[model samples]
Target chain A: MKKILSLGLLCTTILLSQAQAASTPTVSGVFEKTVHAFAENHAPLGQIPASDLLNQPVAGIDEETGFLKVQTPKGLVLVARAAVTTTMTAAAPRETSCSYIGTLAASGTGSSSGFASNCKAGAR
Target chain B: MMVMFWIVYKFFDPLSLESATKNSSAQFFSAITAPFYGLSSPRSHQRVAVVTINDPTLQQFDAALPLSYQRQVFILRQILEADPAAVFVDFRMAYEHTDESLSLFQSVLDEAKSKHIPIFFARGEEGQDQIHLLPPLRNVESYSNALETSSAYPLLFEEGNAALKEDEPSQEETRKPEANAAFDVYRSLCTSTWSGQCGSFHEDDFRRPMMIQWGLHVDPAQTQVSSLANSPRNICAVPFSGGFFCRSIVQSFTLGFRAFWGSSRDYEVGHAYYPLTIGAHQLGERGLGTPAGSPPLSHLLKGRAVFYGTDIRDQHDDTVLPFLGRVPNVVLHAMAFDNLVTYGNHYFHEPSEVEFGHGVHIGQAEICEFILWLIFTGWMAFKFYYSHPEVPRGHGAKLRHDIRRKSRDFLSLSLSVNALVPAIFCAALAAFDLSHQPTLLNGMDEALLYVCLFLVLLGTLVLLRRSAQRSQPEEAEHAHGPEESEAEKAEKFRLGFWAHLALLTSLTAIVFALNELFIQWPNADWIGFILLWLAVGESCESTGFVLTFVNFLNRRSHALTSERVPNSESSSQ
Candidate 1:
């Protein structure tokens, strides 16, 4: 039982790393348009004071995870691909730390299953 | 130096040097040969035609930019009615006003489906998502609208999150890489034209991008117009009177220049008669409402893959190419489609070698380049050496005395010839090589090396003969010296020849490899070529300086001899 569990964990780690590498976006040329960033929980992240990147383009859409990638002045922030109409709204100041949310997502510590459920239901 | 260059090239760029060099060389070669595209323009016209929606087209429809769905439906129906081979729309019709009914657009699509016509629409970032979202455009094939530099048609596009896309297990399995708009058109055209023959080509055939061979544009002034008034048979049906005088003068000058160069104008005449363009308003204009003198639309558009694109000013979808100046983006697709039709599987692409990893490979182009360089250099060596041959001794009696005088004369002549002749020959050959630019047969450094080698070899041979002549007063220099036997002389000759051959072989290979690598690097490669050229010039100047010094010493000796003779005569008096 222990051996089987160890094997499963190894496979899962490999798959996750591959997925991360595959989802990475390459900025080919200059981008002009911008879209707002949202957390995996569909909540808006905190905006920096007098930041130039308040308006940033949607660098890429992660097809596997269904997350919209936005390059921020701090780092990349993942937004739920759902809530297309609402997510395009201007960024508002919020209480959550985007870096903390990213760390939790990367470590798989938070309740991350079905992040799009509420987004899809409330979007329409 | 060659070894050091190789080490540096590997250290900085372990890979990509081969491909980058091949790509630039191919582009340079294409630019050199672009002037001849007009010869094939007429045949290219037979394969494709473009229907442009310009400013006049909007005015005719009485609609603003991005025409309404209903207007598009009307225009699409008109195009299908003409019975074209295929139609590719270069517009992305995004979802707008969800409440609006799409039944009219759906009917037009159904009509095209019933007629068995394949109409492809330009795909944006949404890709397959849009097809799933829009019901009316589900059957319409999607093609990525990205401008590719290296190839006329790229088989795959780097799509959004390409690697992670799930595969569908079907007979014709769609891979993650989306096909480009031009490639889709070519496949459709092939199947339509040669139904049973063009069965499922391997995608790997199109993995490497072939450079776009742009075709010549039609001159409106040279287009054949119908005698009947208001006839749309001629391409002149579209008003192109904006810069008529300037165009006429340029065309006249070009014709005169070609005539002076002894080239015929058959290509121009053939292109003038080809109908490759039709305005959107003219093509979409309906039935008996069409002007009386207008020719039938089917007659022009039939059996041709048509591209539907916009040509509105400030639209910013234009590309500039040789033979054809700045043209709408759709025109590029049309030209690529035509190139595929004309060349099929035998399209011109840069020849690449099979890579077996860890940097072990053999390139055919590089091999051919080396062989040509060797052959030219060998010929140049032979020409320079034989041009200034050693003088022979006269037969019998005073042969030893004659050889001494002739050997002195030979040394002086050889030095002077070595200095000036190589310089002149190098320049002339460099000029000839530049005329045939971007080919494997042209390496300026290789020429200079061969000249230097042959010069050294000849000088050594002359010096050896002169030494033998000084030792022996009875025999000519051609015979063996008293110290050396016949067998020893023969052994020395064999050793000398083998040594010369080995040195030449190694030097040629090293120079060839270095030259090939240098030319592949972008702007930095020109510095290598110029340095090689300057090195050759420096070698020539040094030889010339030595000859000048020798000549000055001889003149001084002659002056001293004249002074001595006059003083001796005065003492005798």
Candidate 2:
């Protein structure tokens, strides 16, 4: 039981860490540059809040994946992602269904080009 | 630094329903209006015809004699006596009577011609193919003598569409869904009768959404429903204009019922049309007749008509109307009889009905979709966080088999171009809709938002997916086990942090280009170049980030699986 619990805790820690990295607001000295970039392109209401989770906090953590949870006070239900980068796309709305996404990555870092397509938000 | 590579890989995650529905808002219109399938509009005509008085005066003891016989005779007599523009006796003569009144009804048709009344007989639509119009039993009259006998079709709904042009008299085309038609059939039926009510049916937004779909307006609020014994059980003759009423064949119902119960009969309700209660009774005890005795038949018949036919053993349409299958023909006549007294047929819809059917989509589809997306994303993150790493399940892989048995079909199943299914579908839909909308600069700029979102979601998810597919031996630099050396954990974090930075830079560049080049800002050239440089930097950094994350997850999963089977497999979800 202790082993199982620790394993669970470790996994949770890794996941939370990744989520936090993902959503961590940039602290800058480089802040002016990041804000300038955001202000230059952002459209009003044109931006859809996209996420692998409902509330993304730790974003750039490796070994982090998906989860299912419901928000209280307002019963906003989130589906359990139950997946990692490699296994996420296996679901399609069956019991463990993920969203109707095509794949886990469209243009992540593996491209042979100089820049990542879009999935490199944490690699800045 | 290792985190840099992982961040770039996270940009490739698949989308969720919450995201898809939010992004695709235009389809909601069609989905919202799909349920107006029931409101049919029978063309109302301008012809005044015969009236069959269904006064209780004719019943033997006011005890409603198996009204199967006298009803036809009474209808025939009225046709003969009214010698009006035309005569329509809505009695179903096809019915079987112990003392057959078939000849008597036929004799009355003969009398109508002999008396010089332009006469017509009606049949329910489903029965039209079979109804043979007999030359009036005594076709010895002339048109100059006011005696042209005619055949009429019984239908339902008035104020539906412009009358079918003479060239297109067939009813098939008229039977399509017409929510966009000129006069709202449901609305006209409700407001035309001088009834006290105003707005047509609408479900309450707070409580109910599915609107009650009954064609006519019967207020459960106003009328005191009689005792179940005395509940108004009557067949109704709804005002279906084109000089006839829709006749429902009860024999069809009985035949169908018997078929289900191992008893077959020849009964059919060929296209029965029901009424829209406009709150006024035109031919009732308190019907359209004025105090001075003039029949309010003009206003009543303005949008109304009449119908009559043979109620036979095996001739019913038995159509399961959209919401509910209904009264057999016999019961329908009885119901129509009851329509004469206590309550008026006014058009109204309960609040609950409309909301379920139409309002919710109009009111909440977007918000619901967005919220659903957020919840789904959060859950995914949570699941991944909680489900991995063994924490040294004290017991070892020795308790379970090391080589996890995989279905032979797994590789063949997902690899057969099926893996390309989503991308292909997405490309098709994206290209298809984009082609239709005029491409605007602003819209191009908006692509930046999508890029940013997809990058963040994809980078992390892609790493997870790849690691899940590969074995651990080749997965170096991964923090594989709960007791993984701190060196591995540090390596994982270092890899992840850099990947995130690399991705953030690339996205910021693309967005900059999008805003400048696509959105056509004055500084577009400079912004685009800056974005282009950032994109290059991020891309280079992204490769390393993705490789590291994927490698780590792959090694971890393989190590865990090799160490324990059921624990890893079952706990994966």
Model 2 Cα lDDT, one tens digit per residue, B399-483: 2222222322233344433335434433443344345333322233233333433444355334433433443333443435345
**lDDT string, candidate 1, B257-300, tens digits:** 54334342222221121226555554522222234444444345
Model 2, residue B275: distance off in Å is 2.4
DockQ, in order, for the candidates? Answer: 0.01, 0.00
Write out fnat for all predictions, comma-separated. Answer: 0.00, 0.00
- Give candidate 1 regions above 4 Å deviation: A1-124, B2-35, B38-43, B97-104, B125-133, B149-152, B156-164, B167-177, B196-204, B217-275, B284-293, B296-299, B322-325, B353-573
Q: RMSD of each candidate?
A: 24.9, 39.5
- Candidate topping TM-score: 1
Candidate 2 — which residues are off by over 4 angstroms? A1-124, B1-63, B66-73, B76-92, B95-214, B218-290, B296-299, B308-568, B571-573
The lDDT values for all models are 0.45, 0.28
